[model samples]
Target: MTNHQETIKQLIEQIGILSRKQEAFKYEIFELKNKLDQLQSSIDASDNVEKATLDQTDYVVKSEPIASGHREWIDSNVHDEATIKQPSFQHHKNQNSKVTHNTPQKSKKLSPFRKSNLEKFIGENLLNKMGILILVIGIGIGAKYSIENELISPLTRIVLGYLSAIGLLGFGIKLKKKYESYSAVLVSGAIVILYFITFFAYSFYELVPQTVAFAMMVLFTVFTIVASLNYNRQIIAHLGLVGAYAVPFLLSNDSGRVEVLFSYIAIINIGILIIAFKKYWKPLYYSAFGLTWLIYLSWFVMDYSNDSHFMLALSFLLLFYLTFYLTFLAYKLVKKEGFAATDIVMLLMNSFIFYGLGYAILNDNAIGEDYLGLFTLGNAVIHFIVAAIIYKKQLSDKKLFYLATALVLAFISIAIPVQLDGNWVTLLWTAQAALLFWLGTSKKISIYEKLSYPLIALAFISLIHDWSYNYDSYYHLEDNLITPLLNTSFLTSILFTTAIGFIVFLQRKGDFISSLKEGSTWLKIVSYAVPILFVFSLYYSFRLEIEAYWNQLFSLSELENKSISDYVVTVNDYSLRDFKIVWVINYTLLFLGVIGYLNYKKIKNIVLENSILVLTIISVVVFLTQGLYALSELRDAYIEPSIYYNRGSFYLIIRYISFAFLGFSILSLYRYIKKDDIHKGFKIAYDIILHITIVWVVSSELIHWLDLAGARDSYKLGLSILWGCLFFPFNRFRYFKE
Candidate 1:
């Protein structure tokens, strides 16, 4: 009995253990099945590739056979469930990897947040703005239809327009608490409507007086401004400001009420200036500025007259100028805000517009034309004082200070041309340029240096103008009574060239050039351009001076003997040509000499180097043309003179001076070519030309002397003799070898 009881207890305990193991396996199988379902759903939800791969995958779970005796003891339901859920785990893992690795292409899906935001923009912002625009247009069209068809009386039409505007404004205000952006669009539409209504009331219907309509529109502008501020909407403010400015023009009846119109614009400006100072709204400030000027400019263009409206126009200009001037600088002066590029640009535009308008008005009136310079100078002084104050107070960034300084210089530069004409302008510009350059180097202010460039350019340009003017005035030699080098124009040219040369000298002598970075554009300009300009200016002035001196002599001769023959006139003309040839050749030789010196000093310059090569080609042309003509002149003057030709020692000197300079130029050019790294072919060609030129000059001179000695018929004999003398020595010494 005891043995049988113990056996029963052991069987019961084993059964309990088996039951607990089966329950735990059941929970594990349930969790695995849940994971498989999630994985399958994700694969379906993925892009096309994964879906196609998943569609081909098999999802069967295989069951493993347990020990035969244990399988019989386990519950059939639990066994079936485990078999159904357990085998899919390994297969799905392998298949998942295959699907991932073999997936073809990915399609980017938009995130939920961005997609919703885009929908909101289309629905709220875009649709609302477009709807408001359409509504405004519809109102305008409806009013036009009613006016044309007599659908409503004019007074009633105006009343209904005001009512509609009031309704929209009130609705916008009510919606401001929840729908601020939408409210702004509606409010802007209402402001436009109000502007049209008020304008139509006064101009079209004639139901309201100008003063009353103006007062109503002013009220509307104030209301829009206050509502925009309360709503904190910039779009609303921009529309309100634009409509307010447009009202005056829309209500125009050609009455030309200058005082009223200006007073209204002035009031609007003052209010806008206040708004700009308060809100720091740059767009508002810019809109007001642009619109105000546009209206004022339109009025000035159409209706202004110096006789009737000078004081009124001037007073209003001053008002507007001071208004915007203070508005532009308010942040810096009052709040000590940092200056930005927009501030600088707006301030400059304001200054320029005021000056431009003021200048036009003054010149048109003719009473204050001379004061234009002082007016410009006054602007400079004011700007300079402003810059000084800013610098003294340290109210803003240094850029503003620099801007003010630049404006001062700009105004001063402009004042020069406005006040003076002819060489006075050029002389003053050169002086200013020199002063600026000196200040630049001494004070180490690069703005001064850069500013000097344009001043010098203007000086050079004005000097050219002076030359043209002088040319036109003194076209005839008899009319040229001024001294050669003592006149205003020539002296100014000299001073201009001298100033530029001095600037270049200082740049080289001081640390300025070395301070610049290598290959800088300014460095290249200073190194090459400045010196070239100086040389050119000097050459041009001297060439003209020499020509003038010759002309002076001819003119005096003409005055003494006014009844001379045309032959003598021709002789005098050729004499002038002779002097010109001498001058050109001598100057060219000097230029070549300077180039050679620079090359010898190893001062490498691309321009000067290329100039030498170019000069070689140009010299060939000048020699063939001018040189041969001069030789012809020498023959004509000495050997075969015209009947009225006046023979003198001057003819001999002119004839020989060119050949001497040509000889020196050849030597200078030869040295340059030898020192330079030129092609051997070029050198050989140069040598050939050199020998030809030498033969030409020597043979020509020989023929001229033979002609002078009454041997004109034996020119071939003389040429043969010269050729034999020249080439015999060249062949013997082998001097022509490359």
Candidate 2:
């Protein structure tokens, strides 16, 4: 029993030791479980923190777990009333990390104003619309107050105006920062107000010294341009331009301070030009163009007595026009849009303005009219140089190049007429037509071709003018035909005729008629009339030559005393025996007929052939009858008295030879027409003309034979009887048979 008891004691000891060891292991397991729970809670809180950052809302810091003993300490120390306000160590550490991550985000959210959609809408859309209206109203109110009140001192008004402008400017700056859309209007309004204030201060009230006023005006202009560039606004530029131009007019007490006004304009335009280089504000440029020109025109029309106004006007005109030109150029460059029709039109307008202003300035300055040509020439040279520059730059725009060329040509055209008088002008015009024709046809340049027509017309008109009215200086009654033929007027006529003929030839060669095939009938008629005009000019030139020769040969001094009309009428003689003019006309008709027939054969033109045939027949009959009358006159002058005395053998020989030649010509023409395939109407007309010529030749020969046989009295009676008998047979057999 004692042994069993001792063993029991050992077992009890062993049980106590095992129980203690189990208790220690249980505490460790409990601690590990607590650690696992704390780790899981931290992971969940981390997920929540990530979700909170994404949502941009609440964040929580998870507390760490502690042992039971430490828990009691923490609960007592951290959760006590006084210590609860203070963060626990772990809580403080987590809170600092959370703040470090979120501080930047919070600051970013608060940096800008959180404007509502409605506020944004009003700021962007409504401000500019209302701003312009308010600006106009403000200007009207200011102007009305200044004009009507007279109560406020000028200095007070000036100060008030400046303050108002400054206020607007500051307001614009504030709006620019907060609401960008309203800034442009506010700033532009300020500029306009400032300009008007400066004008009133300087001109109307003398509130500021002249120098100070000028400086203020310049400052305002600069500010305006700056605002225009910044806001890309044209309204500011327009307002500033108007103020600049109107200042002079508004302040004009009739004491034309012309230089001062122009100086102000020049300075303002310089600012505008600087702005234009950066922005393409068309309204600004257009306003400047109109206002500047209008002011200058007003000054010109009023005839300001100040001699200095002329130079100032000229300088300002150039400045205003060039500034606008540069503005257009800038627009083209910035937009990358190619040259447009409007650009060409603007160029042309600038040219015209330059011309008008130049003329006015030169005329006002008492520059001689002769110098006007020099001015025009200089203008042309400037255009040529510009064209050269454009070409050298290789712009590669055909229309622009053509426009520049056209301008150069136009200026040249004007300059020529201005520089030259009389035939020199006509010669130059004719040459211009030739050059245009060549360019149009050979170069295939349609513009030049169209230009040729007008130039040709001008040349013809000038030629006619020279023929009719420009003869007095170059012509004298005592001058021979050679002198008149060699005169400038005559030479110009010849040149014009030759140039027209060549142009027509080129037109035919180039098939230009196909383009006109669909033209109106009047156009076709005009085409036919061109050849007729050529013929008429030749006829007139020949007639003048013949008349001059006749006056010289006949020693008809009285012919010099007669007017051109009376002389031409009285000198109309178709007598082959009296002068060579009738023979010359016959030869000319033959030459034209041959040419027309050849052309018809080559080109198959029926109108040409028919016209030539008709003209040839008519000319033969008219001249033949006139020759008969001329023979009668010669018989009376040198044959009739001699015949009475029985010495008219010379007249007999001459008359027979003329009749024989007429018979031969009639026979030849009849044979040619009958064989050739001509128009039916022309054929009938030619047959009749040939029969009449036959009868006239035969009857005249019969009468001459009767007169030579000493039956002179019977000659007249026999001639009439014979003509009566032959006319019936000739017409019945030749014309009626056909």
**Model 1 agreement with the true structure over 1-738: per-residue lDDT tens digits:** 454455556656555455546644544444454345444533534542334543332232222111112223235534543442221112233443443536656556545767877998999899999998998899889989999999999999999999998898789878975577798889888888988888888887799997788778878888878876766566777776876776677766678788988898888878876775675666777887888888789879988888999899889988888888877777666644556677878888999999999999988877889799988998899899989988888656666787889899899999998987888889888999999888877787777777888888888899899987884455365556677778877787789889988987786673664334579987777677777888789878877777666656555544223345533322344555665665665766666766656755775655666677567557755865686676567557665555555666666666576766676667766775785576666577667778788788777777777767888789998899889888787786465553
Root-mean-square deviation per candidate: 19.4, 23.3
- Tens-digit per-residue lDDT, 136-195, candidate 2: 587669767876877677687778888888998899878874445677777777777777
Return the top candidate by lDDT. Answer: 1
The number of residue pairs in model 1 that clash at the backbone is 0
For candidate 2, which ten residues in a row score worst on lDDT? 57-66
Please report, in order, the local distance difference test score of every candidate based on alpha carbons.
Answer: 0.73, 0.62
Which residue ranges in model 2 land beyond 4 Å of their true spot?
A: 1-158, 200-206, 251-257, 304-337, 360-367, 469-476, 479-490, 510-543, 551-584, 600-604, 617-621, 624-635, 639-677, 696-716, 727-738
State each candidate's clash count.
0, 0
